[model samples]
Target: MKKRLAIALMIGAGLLIKAQVGINMSAPQAILHVDGQKNTAPAVPASYYDDVVVTSLGNMGVGTKSPKTRLDMRSDDRQNAIGIGGTAQTASAAKAGALRYNSGTQDLSYSNGTVWTALAHKAPNDFVDAENPSKQSFTSGTQTIVTNWTKKTDVNGSFNAATGIFVASKTGVYIVSFTFSLASGTIANDSRYETLIQTNSASSATNKVFKCVGSYPGTNGLSNRVAGNCSGIFNLTQGDNITVNLNQALGTSKTLDADATLTSLSIFGL
Candidate 1:
């Protein structure tokens, strides 16, 4: 009796191996089809129904029947995350088109055959600002105008307008420009109308400065108005501060105009 039962079980296993297999399905659509919810009436299972299939081409599909690629996944949850969790990978440990999570850096990254790189990316700093909404004032001497800029396009938060300081977030060659405008005030022609771009803190021993002086040789004053424009290219290191200065040798004080066209500051990495 035991031998007869063994022969019957062998026949059943042989039938299952040769024919298309279906679990909770009347008709199979692939080599192996499993319908956890037993959804058979609909040609395609709804998102609520959990289904899996191994196509004739040996392609696997989850929550779908007609898979377009080797492994197709679809669901209402909207998350088709696939993780390759394991040990940290060496630079060339994996072949091209491989992905892994770097346990050392805790980063999800991919390999380009040569090295593993983090998938997350960030762009360098590039900023433009204009208009001193709060009109400012300055006396006759070099003054920091980088502060108090009202409309700042500080996407990367690389500058602080309140403190009039710009700290570089990356080491690169940057082009910094600024324009200082006077509110129709008296600027006597004393060859002192200048704009300066300074790098590093004032107390730093290795301070760098770029200065531009406007040449107003006429005896008459500049319609009692003066404008200073200057730009400089500097190799800046991270944590370095940038200061835009305006020097005017005037007896009386002058208030800054809230004009964007007349005054502005712009900086970007090269």
Candidate 2:
């Protein structure tokens, strides 16, 4: 009785294998729907399945052709297995592992889920100014013109090897003073004379402001030609010019050369 039951089970298995569904490789359908719903169209949910193991029978792969087939199965379907016989691939799956745009003209691109672009451009600024001169000059006259003072000097009214004058240019008040010296070219302790002078544009007294004479009249009623010095400050203007000249005003036989010079000159603006 057991042998008879086993033979009947074998027959039932053979019938099940014979009646199972399969692909007819000789003829292919462009669109295949098992129950009234198409299977090849990508599902709205982005993923779905159909009832039986369905596949492409021609050169087009599954999902490549219109209404292509899909198999809905909880487990692997080995009974009615369809061969992946076509070389055609779907558009979505074709570009899945490939780059979209890879041109040099494209500034932006994607890499490893990140978006990137090229860098920016920039530059700096420039400027320049005028250079200053190294020296200035003043004449040997009674006019006390202010020097173009690029710098200050320790030697006031003293002969400058570069400019020959104590120069000034900045407009302000100053204590204008000077010292004079007499040389003994004629006699021993013959005479000595000193004078202080300050002048500006407002002073019309022969281009002279304040003049002070310090000397002793000799036996001949004239200044002695020996050694002398003098300095003083006067109420001055911004561009005031001042000067001093030596004279034998108190003695006779008096010979005075360019031995007299301004020892110190300054202006203190108010």
Candidate 3:
């Protein structure tokens, strides 16, 4: 009876041990092999019972609820890594990769690698008057010279005006010139004339005057037409005006033409 009890106890203990024993796998897949003996089971397809994370390492087996690691046995390798958070990280990456920013979409797109795109809020090169009869107004001292219609005036170009002075709408360097011709049947000795380019206002503070004299051939023909040119450089502030002044005090009032031609009206950085 004692021997039988002892045997029963041993059997119970063995059974408990068997139930608690666990099988260890060399890899994620179970491939059993016996040492110094022929294989009993044929090779079966290997399937991982767990998810495998591969890195630069050797293979490791995990339990049912655990993970596995597979090795990437590369001879040559170089890498460094870090994790960044938030939208700023994504934005920085996109920009560094040369992505396009879409304001409407609020997203970035990879560049197609060709053709330049227009930047935001860029100014155009030239100013254009889209509408007709672009009325440009400029003020002259005492008298105002208003032009009906004319092309872009060049430096030293002549302008015909009803008034004695040619009002300058555009301020720049100019070589002022004048042409005076007497009406038909007028004699040379009849009258004298003066053509001048002067500042519009009369203040001793900042006024400059330039003048020249010539005889106008009577209107019998284009001959005796008095023409003269004066050249000078002027630094004119924007909105400051200039005009041509003709004095016929010396001669009979004859039809006179005068112009303020811009020699070079260039702008530079102040």
Candidate 4:
């Protein structure tokens, strides 16, 4: 009787252990079922038991129990979504294909798997209109004369009205041109007129980028007028200065024409 009782207890414990073990399901379909189903025995067709699956190569999938990759994540809403790490200590420390915003400079920087580069802002480009009627007088001999341009219209705020100079805000090639008319009440012989496009300084033989010369014959009683124009394309650097200058050897009384259209300078950047 004692031997039979011990045998019954051992059999009961073994059955309990076997009933608790199961795969692909919380409740045991069998002692160990690779494709455990609710109310059926483990079978060959794995598709019927799609809840959980582990292949021979150790690949696992959550939603897709048959993982193609080592760990394939499949979700309709989470397609191609990558993890975003907000800010980084330095650009060099960031891995390739990383993006971050720089709080110090407020710029967007990106890593190209090699190096990081900050996006640059576009430079200001502009067109400036010269003074309407620049008036000046020449005493005698070769002298640097100023075109007293009082009014200016600038597209990008690059021109100075008080100084009569165009300070370049960007580095590029520029088209510069000036037109002027000279009128003298008493015209004399040997009068020379020169229109000069000067850079950084007043008109001089060394500083003039463009210059035009013409001889004006004197007129008696009538106003003797001489028109001159000069233009050129110049490569300018930022902070460079540009202005139009007049050089004249008018014997005594020669003045720049006060006509708005006749005397003006215009500049544009390409």
Ranking by TM-score: 1, 4, 3, 2
> After superposing candidate 4, which stretches have Cα over 4 Å from the reference?
1-124, 201-208, 217-223
Cα lDDT of model 2 overall? 0.35
Q: Candidate 2, residues 137-208: lDDT per residue as tens digits?
A: 222223332222222433333223233232223233445444433333333233344354545453353454
Give candidate 3 misplaced runs (Cα > 4 Å).
Answer: 1-149, 152-185, 188-191, 201-206, 215-226, 256-270
**Clashes found in each candidate (C-alpha, N, C closer than 3 A):** 1, 26, 8, 0
Cα lDDT computed for each candidate against the true fold: 0.72, 0.35, 0.34, 0.64
Error of 1 at 161 (Å): 2.1
Answer with 1 or 4, whichever has the higher lDDT.
1
lDDT of 4 at 249: 72
Residue 219, model 2, lDDT: 40
Over 1-270, each residue of candidate 4 has an lDDT whose tens digit, in order, gives 999999999999988765634465564332333433443333533333333444445664433444687665452223434454457545557776678755434456688766777768544466987754646766666556454675566887877765667877666788998878776465567577677887763223234467878786554444566778889888776667787777777667567777767778889988
Q: Which stretches of candidate 2 lie over 4 Å from their true place?
A: 1-168, 185-194, 202-208, 218-225, 250-270
Q: How many backbone clashes does candidate 4 have?
A: 0
Q: How far is candidate 1 from the true structure (C-alpha RMSD, Å)?
A: 7.3
Better of 1 and 3 by lDDT: 1
What is the C-alpha lDDT profile of model 1 across 1-270, one tens digit per residue?
999999999999998777888898878777888887786555444642367888878888877776778898874444566667854557577777777765333456777889877888445465756556555677776565556775558756877777667877666688998877778865555546668898994235478999998765657564567777899999877667887877666656677776756778887766
